[model samples]
Target: MGGKHSVLGNSTLNQSPTIENIQAAYKEGDTSRAQELIKISCGENNRLRLEKHQLLSVAAGNGDLEAVQYLLKEGRVDLPREPTDENPAVVAAYYGHEDVVKELLDSLPGTNWIGLRRLQELDVSDNRLTEVPACFLHCFKSLRSFNVSRNKLKVFPDPWACPLVASLIEFPGFLSECLEVLFLNDNQLEAVPQSVCCLKSLNELYLSHNPGIRELPPELGQLSNLWQLDIEELNIGNIPAEVRKEGPSAVLAFLRAHLRKAEKCKLLKMIIVGPPRQGKSALLEALQTGKVPQMMQNETSIRTTKWELEKPSGVKDKMDSVEFNVWVIGGPASMSTVNQCFFTDKALYVVIWNLALGEEAVANLQSWLLNIEARAPNAAVVVVGTHLDLIDSKFRTERIATLRAYVLSVCRSPSGTRATGYPDITCKHLHEVSCKTLEGFDGLRRLLFQVSCNIKDMSNAATSQKLVGRLIPKSYLLLQAAVLAERLRRDLEDEVQYLTDLQLEQIIEQNPDSDIKDYEDLQTD
Candidate 1:
């Protein structure tokens, strides 16, 4: 305890707080003396003349947790709604008294006293807190505005880790769904967490002056209510300068576009099926080196040669810049049966045949196309006529046209006249290519790229649908779990006066489906 002169020496002479006796008691952390002075001032005739800030500020700033708790227990003081120079929460945070800060926040009124319903706004700025207190989420249940600016924090607090947030499943109104403003400026944050995307009601987010943040998670675009985002002095280089200049709406739009592109850019599985020596491998070689293999000898491929086609430069659309995962099945024509395992509705089926064999080429093409269409009913097929350089130049034009028309007639949809009932194979395209001279190779490559882009787009759309379908069930389960847990917690609290680790484990073992077993396991260590 300090001397009476030492306690009151810094206060104004006329102020009630400067009264020598009370000042000395509070300054010396004497909860009993302080309470006695409070009772005298708050006597029946004249209520407590002491200011709540006077007692709270000194106790909190001095890290006197017990004295602060005593004052709160007396029920004579209430937490300030807005932080002022003498606010206890502010003073506690400023002096790094984490326990005192927790006590101030937890003392609010409610069944869940730590909830934010009473305290709508909190500012703990300029405090050198290395991390946000874990109790923050528990204490600030309905908080609409929060600021933790100019702190040494490295990561934002995770709402999921907070017991109050978990309990919100039963009391939806107490959730952070109303939170509208947040300021996290001048911190050491390196990456924005995906958990922030759950803040659907968040509108304004300030994250300026954080030099280490290199990129924002695209999931952040899921914050549909967000209208203002500030990242003024971060190291994020991927965001376009034009978008950043236009502001939040433009930045959100840009992020959405990139997210769509990422979702749509699935690998295109291109399966090349043909007779043993119909230039399937040669086409792959030509696409890789851009040069035709001259006078290639006929060699049977014993297994599949798998390779990928890197997207060429200058391709703008993400759909068009797909990387083709090429799978060329080799060996005898009989091996085509085993190739059915690789057939996928999302793949591009290329059926090649040696056109130099004349009329015999039609049968080879039909056999391979029908086999693939049977396994992959919705797959896109491209009929490629190979060995065109071996055909006589004079007859090439007429022969190629005749072959194309015949193939189209065979693959056309069955109508009133054509009742053969062959699988309705709508060929994507028909083209002739001389692997030796590389005559029509570029056109073939372009067509494959276009088909691959279309298939990837469809796959992305299906994936998005599945994700949305899963969310409804997931949300329902989460709400159910919350309700059940709250009910079980009440039951346990009523049965036992005090909860310990061993007691909680025994209760969980008795009620197996309480869904609290995981928490007990975590506490075991």
Candidate 2:
């Protein structure tokens, strides 16, 4: 064991710092800052009262061999020979700094590095660490409290076990044996890794404020030691009251009983077409946010939103959280052809017309119908009649019925909705809604979610029933997020209309957020 000497702290010091600060500074390659903080951080005022050996540990963790060399000069600092946090070698090994570990051991003549096999506490939080490197995860066989929170971590490493550790004891369960506290909050994480279930000794988990993080693994219920669980703001909204507001016991019990379901988050193009202020954007806003959309005239809007469905009081795993790439084609008649470019068979279309326009409303509807028929035939369409509030309540039902009949006639006949010979399109349902009163929006929303997820009522189902939805792997979704993030970043730097096939491939291949490298199952949605 290293002797606790007052050599470094023997002089008067101005500041004290926790080990967390040193590790964070080192991680960001702020060597000078770490040195400055460490120099003044001497006495027992902080969590880590830095003495000679602990100061050497900071240098070793940072892979600063020169600092380690200067610190270890001629009994100025005690060299730790034990497996405790005082050991510079263990600190170096925890950060995968083999070079520093070797130099520290070599400096002590006959001394060999005693690795961190039973290190109780490790906190590398407040850094921009994108990953918990597998090599670093290997040696901490007895890691009690681990904190890598407040980092830009998107995903946990695969094979959550280190190869070196795997040969001795089973990987995942080994670390979980003593990992009592885990803080993985405030990251870009999309899905909570299922491997977290391996943490049998995990007592408290802080997973909140992660905007992209949607699904919580049901297997987390297996954590018998978990007393506190904080999960909030998943996908579009907060978790259910029972799970979120209740005690940890209630939350875990709920998760334990909760059935596992994977609604592989579907994304579709939701095209809203209309001329001028017909509440096309309003309809979309109401559907996505469950709030009234302000009626702005002829505004070009393109937005993306998650379909927030109420989850049962149980485990949370991507519950019907479909992402819609909403595109609003709102303009005058001259932009009709340009708008047609957005139409697609896979898209869920909503054609809007101001009911108060009378003959002009019918003509506008007809024109939009023609464009849809020409460009995107047999696509799922929902015809919407806006300005229902303007129509007198006494005649609301009758007026709606009249407009619905006209839409029906247009779709059924081979004749054009106006000209001639217009065949029946895939016009599923027509709903009239008033943007002002927010009437008939519930019906509109219900229909949109239904068609978006391909949910239909089926009677007399079998035991093993095949589900319906645009299901994609969690990997695909993560990849898409990465791609989109990169694309947006590029747009901010330099706006471009389109990306070539080769350019898109480069984006996917270069994405560090996703582990998926294969293009076989890659979806460019």
- Measured against the true structure, the TM-scores of the candidates, in listed sequence, are 0.41, 0.42
Across residues 17-130, which tens digit of lDDT does each residue of candidate 2 receive? 444576567768888877666555543354343455667766775678877776776325766556664466655654546567666667665432345565777776665667
For candidate 1, lDDT tens digit of each residue in 278-371?
Answer: 8888887887677987555456543344454545444443442445667776667666677667776666777778888877777666666676
Alpha carbon lDDT at 498, candidate 2: 73
**lDDT at 108 for candidate 2?**
63
Model 1 stretches with alpha carbons more than 4 Å out: 1-268, 292-325, 344-346, 358-360, 374-377, 414-428, 460-525
Q: For each candidate, C-alpha RMSD in Å?
A: 17.5, 21.2
Clash totals, every prediction: 4, 8
Among all candidates shown, the one with the greatest lDDT: 1
Q: lDDT at 486 for candidate 2?
A: 71
The runs of at least 3 residues in candidate 2 whose Cα sits more than 4 Å from the true structure, single-residue gaps closed, are 1-263, 294-298, 301-321, 414-428, 455-468, 473-475, 511-525
